[model samples]
Target: MRIVIALGGNAMTAPDGGARVEDQLAAIGAAAEPIADLVLAGHEVLLTHGNGPQVGNLLRKNELAATVVPPIPLDWCDASTQATIGVTILDALDDALGARGSDRRTTVLVSRTLVDRDDPGFAHPTKPIGRYLTRDEAEPLIDHGQEFVEIAGRGWRRVVASPEPRECLDAAAADTLLAAGYVVVCSGGGGIPTQRTADGRLEGVEAVIDKDLTAALVAGHIGADLLVIATDVATVIRGYQTPTQQPIGTLTAPAMRELAAREAFAAGSMGPKVEAITRFAERGGIGVITSLDRITDAVTGTAGTRVVPAG
Candidate 1:
């Protein structure tokens, strides 16, 4: 089976913050065990990772250097992160796969996801990014007309648009790698958002695409049999952390969507993931949302929320 796994940003970076390179190495290296296991187990594997923390760090550097140098655009920051994080994943996979004595080769393809130039997302920059600041610091940012929001106990950060990804420019790359038996790693930060001109040329845009949604698009384009979203949780829990909390198991796409309509998942957190998987499930592909530790088990049907057809 061909499997496309989307590793969440927090899953690959230091959960504590700072986007430290050493910690990223450690975290990504830990992920290699499961990725290699899948390859060793004779399944074609492709990888896509998130870079929320890393990009936020880069944006900070861009802001500090604005006076000395031209400010970097959002698309360029996304590109910068894709290269940095792509190298890390490739390096970690190489070390781990080599230790296991497998001859599988790995490669990274910088993906460009297509988004509508007139997407409603551009009208509303609702997705937050970058470092958090205290109210005093945040209030000062408003002088420059930057949008800030106070998220729970966390301080305020700049928000940006999150547009829907209409297509993946490198969808064919995955198929080519799968046919050649290579473990392909691509699509960092939901890929560098791009748009087409009237003359049919591609150019970068100033927005980010939802990583989970982009992963689903790539999985569909590559004709993956399974889409495994390796998130921070073991399973989908309804009413989480309360008296009536419940673990979600096998269910059809429609059933899951119904739960979503009733607000079972938090929009900023688990909502995108569930919606992405539900779409994949409805398209006749198996979807699993589980921790990276249980990825192999999830494939074997022993763990995670296995989304299937109701009939």
Candidate 2:
């Protein structure tokens, strides 16, 4: 099967793993075990992943470097961070496969995605980024025009506009790898969201496109047989975390839509997963969202929230 898996950021970082290189490599190696299995089973795979923590660290690095060197823009920082993550994951997967006596080749594509210049998300930046700052702590930055939002009881954070993705710019390159029998890892952190300027030049935007949604776009573009999103949940639930929560394992698009309308998922969490699943099913691709360990079973049709087209 030609499958595209979206790896969760939490899976890429060990629970106690601070921002150390050793920890990240070990964490990536562990995460690549199941993924390498898919490749060994002769399944064509495309990989995408989250780089929230990685990008956060990169931003902090840029901030620290500002005292010595000029601070680069956030968009450039995001691109650099994703590239670092992609290379790390690819190397770890390659090494793991070799250790297991497999000869599968892995390639990491530094991907870019096209976004609409007029996307409304820019007008309303909602994606929280950078270091979390208390109100007083952020006052200085805010006074200097640093964009921030107060999360009520959770302190303040810099929020970037998360725009909708239009196209995966590296689609052709990734497709080439797929055709050549390589496990391609691309589109990390939603392909470093970019837009075409009025002068027809593509410029990086200071926003993140939802990773799961970008995964859907890649799946649809490649005519994938299955799209698996490995999040932190075993199953998607209606009224999640509440007493009335309903665990749904198999659902049609229409049903998921109705549940979504009722606000069954939290905006910052399950919302993107459900939305990605709906879009994938709508685009004639099958989808499953579940925890990372359940991925093999989910792909074999045994577990996860299996989503199909609406009747």
Candidate 3:
């Protein structure tokens, strides 16, 4: 199957994983193992991963060094994380695929996605980012014009405008590579958000696109048969974190839309996953949500919450 796997943000690095390159590399290596198995199994794979923690860590660094060096814009931080994570995925894949003596080429392409400059999300940034911050920790940022939302029973987290992704600029490169047998890792952190000028020139925007949404865009662009979102959870559940929490085994786009309308999933967490998958499912493609460990099975419809078309 032509598959586009969206690796969850937290999976890139553990919550407690320090801001060290070596540790990040180790995490990516673990992630690459299963992905490599899929590749060796003869499925054409296109990889996209989240870098929320990584980008937030970089933002914290920029903040800490503000006195010594100028702080860069948010989009620049996204680009840095993309390059870093891309290289790490490439190296890890090298180790994993090399072990099996597979000669498949792997490459990383820095991706940019187009979004509307007037997206309402910019006015009300609601995407949680970085480590969960306490009210005490978030106040300073909030005071300085950054927006944050308190996660349910969790903690405060910086939120940014998660604009809708309209198109992927680097998709052609990824597609060409995939066509040539490369397990292309591209579109990290929702693909550095960008906008087009009147002359059609592209400029970076100060926003983040949800990785799952961009994964949908990539899946559609590549005409993928399946969109696999490997998150930390084994399956998407309703009434998350509540007494009534229950796993959704099988779903169709219409059914999920009804649940989503009733707010069955947390807006900050599972909402984007379901929303992205719904879009793909509407396109008559299969969408599976599962943990990183169960990605292979999920792709084969053996595990995870699978979403399909409306009968």
Candidate 4:
């Protein structure tokens, strides 16, 4: 089957959110094992990952050196983190495949995703990024037009607009690579949010796009049979964090949409994931939500929350 797997940023970072290069590579190396297994099992795979921690680290560096040099824009930061994480994934997957005695090739395409300039997301920036800061430290940034929201007792965090992705501009390239039997990695950090100018030139926007939503877009564009969204959880829970919490198994697209309409999932966490999978399922593709370790099982229908088209 043609598969598109979206790895969460937490898969590439330490639990405490350390951004050291070696540690991040080690984390990705571990995550690459299951992916390599899928490739060896004869499934064509396309990989994409989140960049929350990495991009946040870059933004922190920019702030530290703002007086010494100009800070990089958010779009550039997205591009930068995509390359950084892409190369690391390429290296790790290469090693994993080699260890399994497969000579399969892997490649990365720094992609662009189109978004509307007038997206309501731009007017309401809700996606949080960067490390938590004390109110005293956040005041200056707030004065400079940056938005911050206090996370209960966790302190303040910078937020950015998470615009919806309209298209993955490099989906053709990814399709070509997949046809050639290459494990393709593209659309990291939601493909560096882009828009068209009045003169028809492509320009990067100062916003982030949700990776799961972009993954669904890319899956449809490339005609993927299966979309796997790998998160830290093994399965989607029906009543998360409560005594009645239970793991969801197989759900029809319409059933999932009904649950979504009722706000059964947390907005910041499982909501986007369930929405993405439902979108894919509505388009006649199977979607799985599971942790990285259970990817093969999820594909085989023995594990994970599987979303299928309603009859």
For residue 59, give model 1's deviation from the true position in Å: 0.7
Residue-level lDDT of model 4, residues 244-311, one tens digit each, is 88899999999999877865687777988999999999999999999988999998999999999999
Measured against the true structure, the TM-scores of the candidates, in listed sequence, are 0.92, 0.92, 0.89, 0.93
Sorting all predicted structures by lDDT, with the top scorer first, yields 4, 3, 1, 2
lDDT of each: 0.85, 0.84, 0.86, 0.90
The segments of candidate 4 whose C-alpha lies over 4 angstroms from its true place after superposition are 132-157
- Stretches of candidate 1 exceeding 4 Å from the true structure: 132-157
Q: Lowest lDDT 10-mer window, candidate 2?
A: 62-71
Which model is ahead, 1 or 3, in terms of TM-score? 1
The parts of candidate 2 lying over 4 Å away from their true place are 134-145, 150-156
Q: By TM-score, how accurate is candidate 1?
A: 0.92
Candidate 3 lDDT over residue span 175-242, tens digit each: 89999999988888889999998888899987888899999998999889999999888988888778
Q: Model 1 lDDT vs. the true structure?
A: 0.85
lDDT top scorer: 4
Indicate the residue-level lDDT of 26 in model 4: 79
- lDDT: which is higher, 2 or 4? 4
Per-residue CA lDDT of model 2 for 67-100, tens digit only, reads 4555566678667877888889888888878988
